[model samples]
Structures are given as C-alpha cells and as structure tokens.
Target: MSRPEPLQPVYQFSSAQEPVSLRQGTVEVDFNNDRFCGMADLVLRFLPGPRLVFHAIVRSTSEPELPFFLNVPDNLSVSFNGQKMEGFRGRWKANGNTLEFDWIPRSQPVVLSDMQPKNSVAAIFHLFNFPEFRGGNYQEVAPLGCALLVLESEDWKISLQELPEDATREAWDQIKNEGGCFLTHMVKMERKDGEQFSGEDAQEQCFLLDNFLSFINGGRCWPVCGVGLDASGETTWETFASPRPVRPPYSWFNPYKASQAELLFPLFAKRWQQSAEWRDCLHSAIYWYVQANTSGGSPSIDAAIILAQAALERLAHHYLVVDQKVVSGKGRASDRLRMLFSACGIPNEIMDATPDIRRANGTFKKDTRWMDAPHAITDIRNSLVHPVSKKKLHDCHVDAWKLSLWYLELSVLALCGYDGTYVSRLTAKYVTDSANVPWGKKA
Candidate 1:
C-alpha cells in the first residue's frame, strides 16, 4: 500500500481527467437564427468539488460592429468540443471581452434512467470519500441480495494481497480529506441455479448498498458513476449525481471500517428483505439522520436536534409497535425512548459518559430537573421549540445535538442488528478507541 493519490471529486471517464479542459467552442446568444447573436472561443473545465467553469471570448456574429457585451444574452446556449451540452443553469458575467460562468449542481441526486433491469450484470463504480482498508488490498467487502460486492484499489486497479510495508495510519484516511475520487468497487450479480437476474436488479441493489454505506460512514458515500456488463456481454454506462454534503471534519461518530462491512452489511441486507414498508421506514430514518448531522452551510443546531429526536421517535414507533409489538405506544416520549433503548440494550447513562453534555445539564438543571439523558434531551428540545422570554436556550446546544445524534445512530445500528465495534461520539473527547456495540456479546 503505497500512499494513494488524492482524488478530485470531478473527473472525466477519458484520459483527460480532473479539471477536464476543452478548448475552441461557441455559444448561441439569441432566440432567432438571424437576430442578435454571439460566438465565443469557449473553454470548459470540470473542476474538483464537482464544479464547472466556463470561459469564453465573445464577438458579435449577427452584427459584426455590435459590442460583445451587447451581443451576450442573459440565457446562452453552450457548445464545446463540437457537442452541445444542456442544463447549464449558471450565472454569467462579462469582464471586457472574456465572459465567465461558474456553477455548482443542486443537492438532490439526478438518476438518469430509473431502475431498468439487466440480467446477471456486473457493475463497476468509483467510490467518493471512502476509507482505505487495513490491509490496503482488494477485498470482497459484503453481499447485497444475490449480488457480491468487492472493494478494489484506486482507479479500477487491484492491489496485491499483502499489505505494503509502508502502510500507516495516514494511508487509511478517506479520499475527500483532500478532494477527488478513487477506489473503484464492483457489484457482480449472477443468476441462481434456475433463477434469472431481473433487468433493474443490479441498479436497485447498488443504491441500497449506497444508503447503507452512507449511514455507516456518517457521510455521503455514493458511486459518482459506473459501467455495467451483463452476462450476455452487453455493456451499459450508468451515470448519476448525488451531491450531498460529506461528514463534518470534526465528527468522530462511528467512522465505519472496511472490516465491519461483512458483519454489518449482511444484517442490513436481511432488514431490507423484510418488506417494502421496512425499506421505506429505514430510508426515512437515514434521511433524517443525515440531515441532522451532515447538512452543509452551518445548519441550524436547534433544527438538527429536533430532527434527531424525531428520527429516534419514528424508529421507536416502528420497532416497538409496528415490528415487535412490544409496546402499546401510550407513554411519555422519554419513557418510550427509555423502553426503546432498554430493548436495544443501549446503556441509559450515555449522558454521564459525555462530559460536555453532563456539564451542560448541570448548568441549567433546577433541583431534580434533567436527572438523566432522556429527560435532559427532551427538556432541552422543549426549550427550543416552546421558548420563554425568561428561558435562555442552553449554551450547550451543540452538545445536546450531538447526544441526540449519538442516540439516533445507535438506535439505527441496533435496528439493523449490528453487533460490531463502534467509536462512541459521546465520550470521544476522552476515549477515542472503538468499543463493542452495547448489545454485542463483549459489551
């Protein structure tokens, strides 16, 4: 395992990789063919951070004497390398003769073709911001339904089985720490003895794998693009963009290791198999969890705390009333949550373990108020939602937010039946080592 090259979030499939540059093109600047128009020597660069940069030298085409600025249209058509590209919704500015445009894609994922099936397909994709393995070698990480998932080396290359002599802690850091994409993994689905792999099955399984990885890594871990090869030798290219925010740099919450993939992913696969309803419930849960913890632009902590709490309540409802039939769903929120944690074998003293949260609770606790984790959390949440002129929001708002997220993460992992080691965000300031999950045998 030599030091891996840093990956840019943007790259072309061809030889001209990140910051893919194209020269010599034109822009259509008028609505009518014979009306006002402009041509430009265009340059487009697909830069890292998944950004697009457009630069052009403009000149009037319909009226040669007209100023270039006058000829430039508010909405222009783009063409580069003899190909017209659509969806260039960006702001354009002119500085003398040069016109420039820079744009970032929207946050939502854009899947070109909905789950079209392909029988017994092999899918190869590059992972974004994924961590390196301990051995720094090619490994089959997990299985998704009938599909086998393998984690390969960077740029679709397979590494030697043995770890490189120079492998170090620094080598295992995620690629997004710098920027760019690397580490191509594969999903191979084969037909069972007499069964046929449906056309859309491969894509469906890949996205399912994506959600699970994103949840475990506590960030946006998605395949930017991939190629699919069917058993019949038919090849197709799959392109999609999920431009969600990655994990916060300071977040210490359960940095999922490649080693846990085998143990955890199978459990997730089993959960997904339950029913469509179960899948929907899990997806909703993951969405809220990601929003609470990983949204960009300095998301509101008050809103995030509320989101985490709402997710925990939803999971508790599904697990207790809908799935397990353990509770009648008639109780105080904190009591219900206590029952939920008890059922999951999570310790109730998590607040005590996190010194920041504990100290925050002490600062505002009145007499016997906020005696424990659940009470403290709910009380803080109430303060945020139902404000009082005399009641000041806790200065430890971030601590409470993280505590709720910790609870939510544990609950979700337990729901998936995971019994692996996890780094506790609660006591991470003092204790940085990974520990067995609360319900795991060692714990």
Candidate 2:
C-alpha cells in the first residue's frame, strides 16, 4: 500500500473557530500565540450600508516567514468597536516589523471616530498632494494631529493605486470601506512608576489637549493623549495616553480638570520632538509657554516668563538671524526682540485687510480701531529673567503672562500657515485679542 503514504498536517483559521455571526458567537481560534496574533488585530467584517469589508494582511513570524493564510468565507461577518468603525482598518505585516492603518469613519466626509489617537494623533492626508496645496513650511502644513507621525520613526509610503482625476474623492471614499483609515494603530507609552515626566518636550500633548478643549467648546469633541508630572518629581511610575474615551462635557465651558479628567504627561517629552512647521526652537518655546499657562496653581511667573523670553531669543538666533551659523550677537535679548517680532509672521493677503493692525499692503480695504499688544515685552521678560530680588519690584504679572502667551500664540499661527479670521478668532480666544488685529506686526 506504498507504506500508507505518510500523513501531513495542515493549518486552519482555527482548530475550532466559528462559522460567522454578526451579533456575538463563540469561535475558538487555536492559532499559534507565539506567531504574534492578538485580539486587537483580529480581522473582522462589519455589516453596514449593506456590508462593509475589511481585509487584513496576514504574515507568519517563523524563520522562513510565511504569509498568514486564512480561508475566510464570504459569509464571514463580524463587529468590532462598533459598526461606525466599519471602515476602521489596521495592519501588522512584515513579520510585525511594520504597522500602520487608516480609518475612514462612516461619516460621509470621513472624520475620525471618538477614540483618542495613540502613538500618534489621527489626521487626514488629503491636505498633502492636492490641487489645494499652497506651499510653505509645515509639509508645508500645520498638522492638527501628533507631530511624531512624520518623523523617521516609521517608513510610510503612498501605495495608493492610480485613479482617474475625476474619481479621486470617490476612489478614496471607496478605500475606507476596505479598512483604509484604521491602518495606523496609535499605541501607548508606559514608564516605570518612579519615572518623572519630561517637562521640556510635552508640546504635542499640551497643544493636543488645548485644541481638544477648544474643539469641545464648539460642540465637536475630540479626545487628547496627555501626560502628568509628579509634584515631588520622584517615582518609578507607569503612564499611558489619556485612556479616557472622549464624550460630552459635564460643563462644556469648563471641561479640562486635572483631578477629574484623564490627563497624562507625554512620553515624547523632549525638546527634540518637532512637527514640520515648528522647528526645535519653536517646539521648545511653545512647550515652555504651555507650562506657564497651565491651570490649577498659577505657573511659576518668573521662571515661565523667563523661559518664554529665552525661547524667542533662540528663535531669533537660530531661525531669523541673517547669520545662519551665529548663535551670539552684540545686542542684548531685548535689543533683538523687536527684530524677531518683525520677522514673526509674513505679510499675506488676508492679514493686510484685517481691521485694526498695520497693513503689509493695501490688503485691508478699510481700517478700524485695532491696535496690537505692544511688541516690546523684552524689557519685562528680561526683568523677570535677570531678576534683582533685593529690590521690591513692580511688574504687571498678568500682563507679562499675557504678553508671553500672545507671543507664543502668534508664533504658532505663523507655523500653521494660518492667518486672517481663523487666526484672529483664535487670538481672541487664546489671549483675548478681540481687536481682530492679532497678526498685526507692531515693529
């Protein structure tokens, strides 16, 4: 009988997995755990406007890595976080060496669902590579999501298939149903309990929460990943992104609370973390400004303001100084303050037409009573930085705080490539500059 033909074993989706179930069903998946398969990456189907499909790229981990092959039946249907996440996608191919996915929510316009972005914040790539793309820094952009995404941390490529020009939007919309948006999974960072949060590089975390708060006020809430600092500055602590799922506010006007909300200090807490728009100098500068503006106890007035001044100093020395390599100069920090402020933002068409600020040109058809906060905060900032503690001094603590904040906010706007009413409105909200001349260059 030919030696009974030696028997060979084959793998299956599961030794005993289920057929299919939209609700919930027991499916015993007996796959190799050491193979790196997990519930988070479980490829499932969700039935929506008919049936939304999700295709997972499966691969094996053994030495001779094999493509993970599972015979998924056509009738296979499943539900995950929810049906709204029907377009929610993810991938962990390349033997777990690579990870990324895009999620296009069920919303017609394809917005991100209510899940705090992790490892990195979520954003639309439509901004780049579009007829609408007007160039500058920032990709030239001011991404509203986590800045870590663009760094060399991962190799991202646009493998999108070619499409007819007219079908661009329609084609992308189609890709979402196949799990495009859910490609990149935002993982969390954890540290030992005693570990102190890095104070200098929490720019992304701070701005994310700040923007979240601002968005919520407008009735569109978005969750933010955050970090916390220990008052004692001692503890081997483990911290993760704000695990709190975003929901409606108990008090919309005042939603951000330290004790109540899920606020966390960022793990990417270094001056090195930067977005395309804000360089290292700007990143550190903005972070310092956030530290000073934090709630609960007032920010260290002297320290915060001083750091703010130093940030501007660095900005001028590194970014604006005509001598690109020179770090020092003859003038004091204050003497160079005006020069930096002069180069704060470019004179764009929209800024010219703004109501009460000096015009870069005749862009402003008319003028109103709008005067900018004086750009000469250098003296006050210097006073705080180089203090004469012995002498009982007088300075508008509130004004100094406001001044530093205004300076930082203006710099942020410039980086974002935003100007006009968008920035003007933010100025009113951020620094109470309601004069509509927030971008007004006061040299």
Candidate 3:
C-alpha cells in the first residue's frame, strides 16, 4: 500500500522557526522580532476537496524603533496537496501592542483523505483557535502514534486520532467525566468500490463534528446555540412555534409630555402667541385692513390679528423642515405646504400671495440680507428631502437643519398657546443628560 503524502507547507516567515511540537495538526512559528510574537497553524480536510488553511497572529511588545521596518516577509507562498497556490498573501495590522496576519489559500477543494489522522486533525484545531492565542494559553500532548491531546483553560479540550474497534469503556468514562466538554476530531479512510474500502465509513456524524472548530481556531467562543427546552426538562426540537412577544408599558396619559407642557406653556405662551417683532412687522401692513373691517382699537381685533399672524408664522416654519434622506429626488415642499394650508381652511389665494403679504400677515420675507432664518431653514429642508445638488453641505449647514427643527417646534408651541422657550431648554437638557447612556455592546 502506498502511504499518503504529507500536506504541503503554505506559510513561512523569514525570521521564524517552526514549532518544536504540534498539538493538533497545526505548527506554530516563533519569530525573532522583539516587537512581535507570532504563530501559524495549518488545516487539512479530505472530502470537500483536499484543502489547507493557515492563520497567524503577531503582537507588538514595544513601539517600533523606526517607522518603517521589515519584521514580516514581503510575500508568502502556499502549496497544498500537490497544487501550488499563486499570489498567496498575508495581511498584518497593528492594534496597540499586537498585530494579526491572516493568510488565505488561493485554491479550493484541497483534500486530505490520505494524510495521517494525528497531523491532519491537530492542524485543523490550531487553525481554528488562531485568533485567541494572545489572551489565552494552549496546552497540548501528542501520544506516541495514535492521538494528540489539546486544551485551553476556560476554553475547551480536544482529542484527535483514529478510534480503535474496541475503545476501552474506561477511556470513554474518563473523557465523559472530564466534563463532557471535550470534542472528538476524527476522520475515517475507506476504499472506493466493493472489495475496495467503502468511503461511506469516513462520513462524519453531525453531533460528533465540532461545529465550533472554525470559531475555536479563530480564538473565539462558540456562538449561542438555538436549541429550545420544554417544561419537562427535555429538548423540545420542534420545527416551528410562535415566540412570546413583549409589549412596552402603556399608560392612559403621557406623563413626560404632560408635566413638561404644564411646567412651561403658561410662562412663555404670551411671548410665543404675540411676539413684538412679528406684531410690529405685521401691524404696519395689516392695521388699516383690520381697522376698516372691524372697530378700530378693539381688543377683539388685536387678538384676531395676533392669532392669524401666529398661524401664518407656524406654517412658514413647517415649510422648512429638513432631514437627511438616502434617495435623491425633487422634494414636494410647496405642494405639501399648499395641501396643508387648504386642510387648515386657508384659501389658495392666501397661500399664493406675494412675499410682502406673507411678511406683513405672517413672518415670511422677500429680500433681506440679514439672515432670512425662514428661507435658510427652507433651503436646508429642501436639500434633505430633495436630491443632492452640486452643492456640498458642511457640518455647519447640517447644524442649521437641526436649528430649523427646533424653531419649527417652538412655532408650533406658540400657536398652541404654549411657551416656546421651554422646548429649547428641555431639548438642551435632554441632549446633555443622554451622553451618559451606554451606546454599544461590550466585547
């Protein structure tokens, strides 16, 4: 019988030596660089085509003496199962005191049926745990000719070798007693035809297969399992079932809004309801019309004028709401505003009036250089809702969009006889206090 050839070597560093021993089929390499500690593992598999995977990790012990130094090879070459991999490259990155290199093979379906079980399985496990070497230590024992023993504290333990026809019951009991956590890495070799070795014997069992080998090789824990349990303490392996859904807490009233509105509305309502700046601008243009239509100097006329002006100013603010939109296209701000006005009982003629009428009766303006806040707001809103124009938006310009939202909110409060200043204060408080909230998942 012809012996199976050893798997090919795919990675080697210029300043490193191969490991003194292998735990699984993997080989570790130690480099001479003071700035880095590195290792490599080799993985071999038979069925899905003969294959090899190599992984390495480099750690930085201290800052580099020179900004540019060659601690790693310029290029890497890998050969697997008699096939040469072209352009095989390794990647390295420095993270604080450590660097990592991942070298992937260029070819596919590299089989490993003929390789000896001890070397093949060991290499596969080493490749799987390549990612966790820095924070963890690996322990391995190689038996004379049959099996290899490997373990990592707080991680896992594994044994790889061909099983005997009569594996001792004591051996099985000892392994099971050792926490039933150790995984068996195995492969069976059989011939192709009748009177020849039947390959079916080599097929792996699903449960016996370590589903976490890839992650373990990558130096990470296995992902959460998806098994479900029933009340009887037995595994409830069902195809489909509805999960219990959680509902958010509900209340008859929104306490946060109620308390906030009550605390702020009365204090600033008058300023919002009747701003001197808005009244002065509108009174000059509409005073005569109001007097002619109603009794001059009547309090009712003044109140009516104020309500009408407040409504218009609120509408003007609404016309300028801006936000980031992923897709680009012309925004229908004008059409939407017209529809809103019609719904609010405002006539089309009033909606279509000249800027002067808007400025005099509402807070809109035509030509003024002193920062037309409403127009600036409208431009931002259009930019967000419409297609990105040739114009580039800066950080300050984005801030303007937020300001427009705040001001619009205030305008709404004012129209509703609530204090607008309270909205500003509450917004500032919420934003400041929210900074302490944790934002992302822990490692």
In order, the Cα lDDT scores of the candidates are 0.55, 0.32, 0.29
lDDT score at residue 364, model 2, on the 0-100 scale: 26
How do all the candidates rank in terms of TM-score, highest first? 1, 2, 3
- lDDT per residue as tens, model 2, 1-36: 122111111111111222221122121122334232
Higher-lDDT candidate of 1 and 2:
1
Give the alpha carbon lDDT tens digit for every residue of 1-443 in model 1: 34333222223432222444422345543332433224433222334445434444443344433354554344555453334444444656655444455322233233333346544345544454444333111334322111122332111211111112322122223333553443333233333342334436655666676677667666556654544556665655444453333433333333334455545666777786678877887778777777778433446888888888888888888888888898888877788788888888887764555666676556664875465677767777877887752445466577778788888888877888888777777666532367788799785
Worst 10 residues of 1 by lDDT: 153-162
Q: Where does candidate 2 have its weakest 10-residue lDDT segment?
A: 6-15
| Each prediction's TM-score versus the true structure | 0.67, 0.33, 0.19
lDDT of 3 by residue, 1-443 (tens): 33332221122111111222111232222234453445554433221222244555555456655443355564543332233434344556555555455555554322323321211111221111011111111112222222322222121222223222222233344334532211122322112221221111112211112222211121111211112122343322211111111111111112223233222323322322255543333233222222212222343333333333333343543433311132223444344334333333323342221233233334323343213334343444444456474333332232342333333334333333432123231234341121110111222
After TM-score superposition, what is the CA distance of residue 94 in candidate 1 from its true location, in Å?
12
Stretches off by above 4 angstroms in model 2 are: 1-240, 243-278, 295-298, 322-330, 345-376, 389-393, 422-443
How many clashes would you count in candidate 3?
A: 25
The CA lDDT at 274 in model 3 is 52
Number of the top-ranking candidate, with TM-score as the measure: 1
Candidate closest to the true structure, highest lDDT: 1
- State how far residue 357 of model 1 sits from its true place (Å): 4.0
